[model samples]
Target: MSLQQQFEQAVTDSKALPERPDNMTLLKIYALYKQGASGDVTGERPGMMDFVARAKFDAWAELKGTAQETAMQSYIDLINSLKG
Candidate 1:
């Protein structure tokens, strides 16, 4: 399958994982999904008070320079691992 197709399937699969991933893994998932779909972090980072939002933003920012295709592959890999 094409990378985009695999990535889309992974996105659907992510929602149905047998078990929920831990906080950090969830954050990584969010970051990779964002980077893959949207490319780079945008807008202001969430304020310190918004812990969850801040964490997610930081996670995405960490992948600022990552190419979308790379991020998509990483996301697909992560989701597959979680599925196992």
Candidate 2:
């Protein structure tokens, strides 16, 4: 399957894992998915007062300059690990 398709499928499968993921794992999934789909962060960072938004933005920002294919592969690998 195409990498993007595989990424999408991994996202779906991740939600079906036997055990729930911790908050950090969820955040990593969110960040990697965003990076893989959109490539790097965009717009302004969320204000520090907005913890959730700030966290998401920060997580995505950390992946700045990462290649889309790399992000997708990383996301897929993480999902597979979580599944097992």
* Residue pairs clashing, model 1: none
lDDT (C-alpha) at residue 40 in model 1: 96
TM-score between candidate 1 and the true structure:
0.98
Q: What's the lDDT for residue 1 in model 2?
A: 95
Task: Give stretches of model 1 more than 4 Å off.
Answer: none
Whole-model lDDT values for every prediction: 0.99, 0.92
Per-residue lDDT of 1-84 in model 2, one digit per residue for the tens? 999899999989987998989888888998999999999899998887999999899889988999989999999999999988
For model 1, the local distance difference test gives: 0.99
* Best-matching candidate per lDDT: 1
Please report the candidate that would top TM-score against the real structure.
Answer: 1
